[model samples]
Target: MTDITRKQFIKLTGAAGLALAGGVGAPALADTFLHKMVRKPIPSSGELLPVVGFGTSRVFDVGRSAEERAPLLDTLKILYDAGGSLIDTAPMYGPAEAVVGDLVARLNSRNKSFIATKVLQNGKQAGIDQMNASFHKLKTSHVDLMQVHNLVDWQTQLGTLREMKQDKKIRYLGITHYTDNGTRELVEIMKQEQLDFVQCQYAMNARLAEEELLPLARERGIAILCNRPFGRGALFNKVKGRELPVWAADLGIHSWAQYFLKYLLGHPAVTAVIPGTGRPDHARDNVMAGMSPLPDEAARKMMLDHLHGL
Candidate 1:
């Protein structure tokens, strides 16, 4: 096992006083996240993207303080070096958009990011203005994807996004739904709209998306972006004392993060999962899940069983 030191990891990641001292070359294993998943087409432009992404929610809300953001800065660089680039954020996530913008701008890796953010607006101009703020903060000419935050005021935001999409200011458009109520409503809108993506919650414990939401997304061909894949740290808490199962070796899961991530990733309808991270070690563990052996139908069922047994 690689004992990655705090200082050394930071150095390797180019964050302030630390570096990537060891574990730079992680071993290959089965059941790793990237075993067989391929990019799916956007339908509108036939663009293909990897099935894993990073969420910048509470972790990326470090505001303008460099000290509060130093670790996050390193995490971003680590993500880029590790070949993981999809970053999801929003104006609601405090200073998340700004922090991501500042850090990536410094690294000039903004181009490498699959930038996605949200705007919560009750009015048309408020939506437009907030999105413009997002663009300026993210330091990008156009965001890769933009969603109406939490599907709130979709009546105005959805119409506004469709217009913006036609203007080419954003590459993709959709709405987000985080609550149970929002899920039902958003699913119906997705069935009726010509959207390219949808952001929502999905995790082991919260299997609400599995019932009808994810299935419908699969049938409709709308790319589903999973938010709170870590369930806001609830999954980690649940597995606190549990060691990585021995069978995890057969599946190539060396960490609990991989265990949870692989289960969510095993879903065929899932386009990408965005797990938030503030520490580099946790970030690496999360990215490594993208390289796991994908569970087939039977294996997926087994995974569910294993998770419940936890």
Candidate 2:
């Protein structure tokens, strides 16, 4: 195929299949676009969820000050309208739960979204209280998935999360660790116990997650939630002047963002990749990455080589 121009690139999206648009009175299915990676089955339950996810880490978690969160409302709407369902947030992110709570309530999209959050507390009672706060803040009856954030007080909190899952207040229970050190321990925790989802940073630039965490998740049938898909803007900067490889068309990757996102979502264990953003265009581009052909082995290797060279 010939090289796709920047303008044409902007118009043609990836072919991996994604549910990019939604219509009222008819909720979109997981397989709406056929451009994103195929939906993965939840380990504990059979419900299939899209492998692309949304995060509330940076500017998005700020609803405390009116000026700080004015744009996030629009961003969330874009996400919902585009068939995005998985929303990952935590008390670790300042005011994110609060912002999400208000917006979800106002939008009345609480049931439409799959809520995933964390417990950042010590001991069983404290963990329960924090979860209650999360529910109250998010204005939801229960969370879709609850995780122990970075193993903080894991011993004390994990048991409580397990109990909540038993009671059905939460659908899934899991643990998270961001660093490589955390990976081994998280893997051990998965080995010892049953978990539904795990959240961590992953990108073409950060292959550390691939080294062991992802493999373990795949082994346990645990869903992996990937954060920092853009490498916190570093990857974007690296590709600023670079053009998409001509062969990208074979995999349906049209832009640098889509190239990077598709590469991560292509991984087998990745249940979802949560890239943070507050802009409508960025949200659309990121969500659009969810739709189409995740490159096969050969294309992925070439993508890494080209990105490294760029």
Candidate 3:
């Protein structure tokens, strides 16, 4: 399939009244189209973040060899070109942090990217040391956001994070957990500390966060970064052979990825949904969900019903 430029995409979809040919293989759309993409503000600082961002977990843990790094370069370019910037990574993810740093440096997109990494050490000094290492690996002195991964020694780590934020080593500080089991503890932490962000699992299959974590984040003015948005590819498996509902096209959803992402974006409290992908085509498909006309309450319910039936 031939990749389409932003102008070609707009002309094809707008003037020619055509849909995306295959939902992938297209490069990022143009800058003029970026303004039309959905953006939600960080409650504490009112800085707007694109509703769709990148994630580096299992997919980004690869060797520094060109064979391993080539596709990743394309993926990051597709993401940045499409107006997506926020990237979530952690020291626990092995070489993922180094890969992101190297790739971003190669692309010279450090100024354009919103880099987020985490610290999971047990002691305050250890936490500080881990974050310092993150800065070095990320090839930047100042990071956009730093999170306490899974609340590991959260109290000790948060103190370090707070100090870093004050010193301008990191712009924001928050906590993260990938399971519904951690929501209660996250809520308690939110009530006690002033946080700029909270990342938790919130997807079609995982609705537990919606019951409490999401509402309280809004109440406390904390930005939400949703992880496991695709249930680690379980949602795709569930609909492997099925076709999209006829009404999905009305919202400009061309693929199942957009279908799932749009459902999460439908909730008002969701700030951004980070779906990890190493494939550039998948990256292109993922960013398209950040556009406007996302699913509404009624549409979301319909989607839920459809998924349940599937």
Candidate 4:
């Protein structure tokens, strides 16, 4: 497939028209909308990742039924067909890891994905045991990335992850935290720990990361995975009845979701933004945020001011 430029992709996807609940209304375009996945490099290793990644939190905890698996299968297909790769899940998210593993396998796309799962245990032996179970749930000998969830026993877990990395059981090591309480400690770890990635919450409403954490990550050469870029959908409530600002199209943002996500992608430190959803069209819309140029300093300020004024 030939790679399409940002404008070309927007034009292609935009022409498919819109659906209120999901994304493009055209099902045929779902399979052939465009062939580009915007990529950013892992600061620590120069490894490239798609700027738009999927998160499986509450969305993938489904029972083993054909009706339940059908939409997920389509979602993965749309993601892969659009060139997306990263699929972030954790043992904390109920059966998400297993469900994701099953869906990707059903789609024959296991090799095409960059699976990132987490270890949330506290002790060395327990951490080791949990991670082994994660591997089993993911149905993989090696995962693309393994993270210490919420910095829980990070020292022990990180050490275990390091050994696993050496053993090639995992390809990278990271740490994740979703609240401000952990920011200070996360900053200290980024300064001292040898980490490949850091996952945190950073949305327009939750801009705490902009003050120091984001800059620290950039300075330390750590890839940042931005979670809850939409403020867990709370930001949307502020703009419930408002239409997208006319200038949004200039940045290739056609929907509120894309606008919010594009705002996050504008930050240089953000390697990827993982937004959780179970709908295929919504996933398509999320990935489309990566297809356009990010906001510049002036545009970013305008976006902030506009949202704040509401």
Clashing pairs in 3: none
Q: What TM-score would each prediction reach against the true structure? A: 0.85, 0.85, 0.90, 0.91
lDDT string, candidate 2, 1-310, tens digits: 3444323433453322222232112234333333443566776577888766678876565546667766777677766766677888998888888888887888899887888999988788888999999999888889998999989999888889888888989988878766667777777787777778888778888888887888888888888888777776667667654567778767766567778988988888888888776655456557767776677678788899998887
Residue 249 alpha-carbon offset, candidate 1, angstroms: 2.1
After best superposition, candidate 1 residue 210: deviation in angstroms?
Answer: 0.9
Candidate 2 vs candidate 4: the TM-score winner is 4
- In candidate 1, how many Å is residue 99 off? 1.0
lDDT of 4 by residue, 182-296 (tens): 7777888888987999999899999888989899988889999998888865676676556678888788777777888888888999999999867776777777788758887
Clashes of 2: 23
Model 3 clashes, total count: 0
Off by over 4 Å in 4: 1-24, 30-32
What lDDT score goes with residue 61 in model 3? 95
Candidate 2 off by > 4 Å: 1-38, 64-70
| CA RMSD of each candidate after superposition | 6.3, 6.3, 6.0, 6.5
Candidate of highest TM-score: 4
Report the Cα lDDT for residue 46, model 2: 74
